[model samples]
Target chain A: MSTSLDDRLLALIDGGDDAEAIQQLQTDPAARQRYLDLVALQIMLHEKLEGDAAVVTPEQEAERLKFRALVWAGALAAMIALAVTAWFALTASDVNHKPVSVSHSIAMISDLSPDARFADATAMMNLGSELMAGPIHLTAGRAQVVFHSGTVVDLTGPCEFEMTGVNQASLKLGRLEAYVPPDAHGFTVQTPAGVKVVDLGTAYVLHVRQDDVSDVRVTEGRVLIQTDQEQRELAADEAARWRISPSGLASLEVTRTTARQVLIDFRGEASQGVNASERYNVFDPVGAWRFTSAFEGTRLFSNLHDVDGKPTGISLTSRMATTMAAGIAGELFVNPVDGFEYNATTDGVFIKGDPDQHHVIFHFDGLEPGGKYAFTFAVGLEANNQVAPKIALGASTQTLAPHDKTRVIAFDDIIADAQGRIDCTVTPASPGVCFITALRISYQALQPTQERMNP
Target chain B: MAGPREPEQFVQHLTAHQTRLRAFIHALMADWHRAEDVLQETNAVLWRKADQFEPGTNFHAWAFAIAHNQVRLARLRSARDRHHFDETLADQLASEAIEQFADLDHRRQALAICFDKLPKKQRELLARRYTANEPVTTIAKSLRRPAGSIRQTLYRIRTALADCIGRSMSREAGQ
Candidate 1:
């Protein structure tokens, strides 16, 4: 299939061998054939490399322009795509001749799904894709909707939301800060008005409200809010709210609220101290005790086996449990000799046998291995540091608020022979509010035949 | 005084000869990306030494000389430690590479008929070499073969390809 001088020269050129040796080979047919042989091999090598070449996207193309040059700076001359180049140039030049079109204003939203229309009706973003919904950066308004996952979206004021891409989103929604991480399957949101803003992987919020314009602000992270027309990004310290009737977004000024105020606003004004309770089977002597709030407390419940002998940790049970407010940063401590920790601010406390601590040295006797144990917790301003839990168990409810004396609750079967451990750690929710206490807990080693039930 | 500033001038100069130079560098390095690196360095040198470029001279040849050095620098900088072709070798290669690409014109004429006759893999391999300008080692790595063996196979294939292209071109020309 080999040919003559000019023909070999042509073949050599096609093989990316634009060298004088090739020209010289053209002078000598034998050398030309060898040159042709060498280049044809190289061409084959190049082809075998691209297993499945993917078409580059615009952003990818721009990035590639930056990195690829440093890689193959002058390896191959690109045969310019004359048609595309000509068309672009022609369009660019002609744009100067026409009058500019009027700009449109609209809100934007986007999500991380291949078919997700958060970006635009036409634009579908895949997982990790980002899309901007509108041209005008939303400076203000209220947008309420439900998100794909369990996320709620409510932007009631001014914000500039920029859509960087499908997965990358930015929100300048002021005052309100809510971020949903891409865990599990997706994320969803429900605004106060029941508007749904659901995202398979992200969450959104509003700094400004639709009617009652509270100066909501975003201090960190971004929230993707749906505007009347598109998706927008609301960034840190930026506030956005919605205006009624015409239903548009407008920028709003902010007054930074205190940490407590921020929490109260999110939770609601009717919030009382937090409280919770649970039930336990004092095994071998199978019986149930009515556990009550021993003191004003922040947290309640126990990591114990359930009715079916399965383990369940911490549950909000009674009105006492519900009314107690354990400001996320309430202080708590445990008493090792007795059993239970008390929250100073709410004066609430709960007791669990040492088995929960996995301590082999200290545990209530007759507590069966793998048996369910229930505990309660409460925290509120009105809680008296009384031994309510002790009283409920037919023991003295003394040592309430204003009295730091320990209440004696004696129970026989005090055998501490267990192998498992429960390390109770308490941490303050805010900087200057609370401190935590620790305890070493253990459980009786289950016999080989004992089967722990699953709840 | 008469020409543009360094970065600007270099950009303009590159834009002018980018295609040809890219093809030449592709042939020399057997990699489009590496060729691109050499092009950038060539532009950088051109920009830095704008004073050395005499006016009304063959800028192409002058730029080519800088490109030649850049190609060598590129080879040295490359992870492959590929053949660091000297200026003379680069010049020889650049010119020859252009000649080889000229065959593409003929191939285009017979492409429709010849494309169908060639094996799909071979045609694709030809496209990767002539169109994408990917590296031999890159291709070999994907193919899971020793680079030396890949090179030998490519050399053989090139011979066959040249024969195929020639026959197709002649047939097309006759028509």
Candidate 2:
């Protein structure tokens, strides 16, 4: 019977088919369709199953070895570059540029949060302060620098950059977004890998990995990137990557990708109603809870349930729930609401009072040992002038300040115990109202890297 | 740096379809590392032959053809490896899979729902078998179960998931 034939086909697909199953599939259209569907299912199943389980053949092993060698070589070159730079800084006198006074400032610190911290106190530049060519290290929060020529550079810490000149800067670590206007044409950003990115007239994001591999994403206009041996011009929505080999050899690779592609985050908008259609498209979460008034009557929400209408085994405990208008003073929001109606009332749950009085707790059981998980949530202060709340997930606790907008917090790389249970708690710092709109707990998967050049 | 109309259109099409193109190559190669290599090589070729690709045509099909050629070339290079499938069977499967590309998204959604419906034990087992790529024998040894029993359990779970997915998809169509 075809039932037996179907089973046979399934087994064959699992084992990489023999001549018989392939013959059967070639002749019968029904069987062929069944095979296709099952194979698709198999592929989907294979995707869900991750980790190093498959037996690595000799070829794969060789590829892995080659990759490791390249990475090591890149590291060696970065160390060499760092050493050379340090040596030049100590020995070279007025060869590059005239030594400026301590009070001389080539750029002004345009904007920064109150919480922004700098590694070097002397390196901190205020608005309209003349900035000398020196290292600027942002220890925490974000900082914006406006070059004398009008190039606005936003640096997110922990980041390190040096003002080489009024028209030039060098990113040593972390990420920076540079908006180069027409006046700032030829403004250059030198990466640690010795690649110089000269803006023709554009906005671009430059990220320097800890390994010194630099990634540049052009959001608008165009930019020319030059290494000692190679130079390439990248246009809008294009990305160029430069890396140095262990042998001090430099290479570059270019691809067409948006800046958004480099950062992994949830894509769909969160609202007040039940988002039954909002399924996670990229990575699956272990437990997810949407605090919107979508399910108003239900006092208990399960963590294993999908906000998009799928059921799971685990559950989350909510103390109080309510619906409110979008604009609540002191509320902090991470996403923009340009298209959303301001007057509309969205559903949300509140965690009020102090930690000892009332706290929202999420219990996750059966976590994989040695597995890392990310606890993400959308939260905002409901009342004006309320103190920041304390968020506890696993063993770590974070104190968050009160703000008018909603902020999404993602605590990643939290390891689970052998028992697989992780207790997540969110406690308000004061006797004020705080709202949680969305929550998700998912396994942490490493971001995939692009292919690199051998040189 | 904007190029002629053909190159601009090619870049646009390629960028839009990059994810799907990688997925197709992944389906063909099974190994992500290998699929990445093939996709990169295919991208270079696609860019070089951008003039040959029509502006208004199906870029997905054009890209898939190039990826398919690359997959065949890779297979030939690694013919001595014992882990890969027979060329004839793999080709047949690849063709069928490509033909069903239009239905991929719908089937994927159904599969996601069906996956959530599985019992915790079954989910764990499936994860071990699929995610960890642990062989059935190795899993059985770890769990102190017979290899045959473990295999049978996997088969039953797969059958149940397939039936569940079919029902959900049909229900959606009816709605």
Candidate 3:
């Protein structure tokens, strides 16, 4: 039982050398038992350390202390407000005046989970309860609020939103979908980015990222976006993204096709295609490749569907652009679906391509020469130390940088060749493998006429 | 499969074992935030698959298995950025952690007793280190002590607590 070995083992564990540590443990039974015991103890200690280490800034600590003190003051203020309202009600009744109530029911909680975690347990949100203007934090689980003016909002957790008024709410953070009917036409949502999105009889999904950049996607009708510097309107299927920098709202981009849905379902079955009449065929692709099979010299992947029992006038020919060593053509494996813990169902193709001259040329047939197409693909990190790979779709090339979270990169309006040859070059950042999933190329359709109107 | 239990009964069972299930997930994942997310996801799955779970059986084991699968799925999904443990290491740790769950209640009680035995200053230091999640460097800077010394103190405290728990468990067995 050398303490030196134990220390080395613990250091190794922290440095993520599990294989070596396990190997050493297997050789010594006593040390293995000791390691297990220590691991259990470590887990308990980590459990106690529930708060994130990176979040404890000096300013945040000071704010927390101030918040604790303000809680008492807030309680006292609430009591005083209650007393004043009661006194006013009694005096007004004696004078034949209308009695005033302290709390106004601004919105009703339409839907919420019973096990949803709330920031304040005392201020639990019950279904159909009239919620007054205050802070509502859904730490976990989704909740919906229906305002008195017929506006309905669904909040996805861990969201924090403050109910400012009957028709207005400031979303401090998180994702929310608001459906404003004609009666509640002027429902407004304020974000931390200083931008206020007012509904003009629309259903819109607003997401406020951790960096204070808000993205609003209008699914139906229109929305009036008002920032401190400028005001704009977003119609149906349009998306507006604006970031709040130190200087104020900067980098604002409004486009009709900024956010596109995955046209081809590559989740389980490979070689799936979008039907011409499908709802998602707005940006229809001539063909799609679901690279299910191995690269055997050169292979052709057919489109999922066929018109009139014949080929769908679209196909993809995959061939090695540059020949490398035998095992360099990235491994094709099925990635399990996240969040669905049970049911070991494989969802999508996880391609781990090699670093250097491992290039694959996808020749998409049946496309007009010089046609504008949007090539979108999702790249994810497969190993801890792996750098995001650089990928080129046609002429548009981008280095997929390592992100804190997984994201999709879309190359828009790239002109294809007469024969529709799209060269996909995968240059890995590091020796480790990078994941490529949900590859799609769609023909960019013509934009509808602008429907901008002054409200 | 047996008929689905009453909704109230199912909820009660879930609530009763929620903490232990979360702890089990945390043990396997080694990331608390990720573990919480997995726990919430598991809860949703449990409710959806309630019919699959037979009543009067080992609900804890069933739930543990689901959580285990969830941890695996999450690891698989985020395999690139996950630095802590690979699938093989996670699976090994998970099996061992589940075995330790048999004496979890006993160990918890022992920990509580050992925690009470610490001095007020040491207890406060533990609270600051653990509950507040303040790094050793931060705590050391505030207390005007070396970071190494603070880490050493914490290591010694944890070792002592582990020893105390072991002694308490042995005493209970003797009784």
Give the true-contact fraction for every prediction, in order: 0.03, 0.21, 0.09
lDDT of 2: 0.59
Error of 1 at A307 (Å): 99
lDDT of 1 at B43: 59
lDDT of candidate 1 over A203-287, digit per residue (tens) = 3334334454433234345444444445444444333444433343343222221111000000111112222122122111011
lDDT score at residue A103, model 1, on the 0-100 scale: 39
Q: By how many angstroms RMSD does model 2 differ from the true structure?
A: 26.7
Candidate closer to the true structure by TM-score (higher is better), 1 or 3: 3
User: Candidate 1: where are CA atoms >4 Å away?
Assistant: A1-64, A67-455, B1-19, B30-36, B43-63, B75-117, B121-158, B166-175
Q: CA lDDT of B125 in candidate 1?
A: 60
lDDT of 3 by residue, A1-455 (tens): 46555654555433345566656655665654555555555555554443334456575466345434433433433444344345434432221121223276666676664445778889858755568778889887768887666678887778899888767889988888898878678888888757999998999899888887789988789898887767789887787888888877777777775223324323322212222324222212122121323433443445423212333344555555452311111112222211111121212223344556555555666554676777665554433333555667766677655643323567888776877555565555554444444455555654533555454
Report DockQ per prediction, comma-separated.
0.03, 0.09, 0.10
Which runs of model 2 end up more than 4 angstroms from their true locations? A1-3, A15-17, A49-455, B1-57, B79-93
> Lowest-lDDT window of 10 residues in candidate 1 chain A?
A259-268
lDDT of each: 0.35, 0.59, 0.59
**How far out, in Å, is residue B125 in model 2?**
0.9
Q: Write the per-residue lDDT of candidate 3 for residues B1-175, one digit (tens) a residue.
A: 1113455566667766654675677656656566666776666556545566778888887777667766755664454564466555566666766666645667766777887898888878887876676778999999999998887677667667767877898899999
> In TM-score terms, which candidate is top?
3
lDDT of 3 at A82: 47
Minimum summed lDDT over a 10-residue window in model 2 chain B is located at B1-10
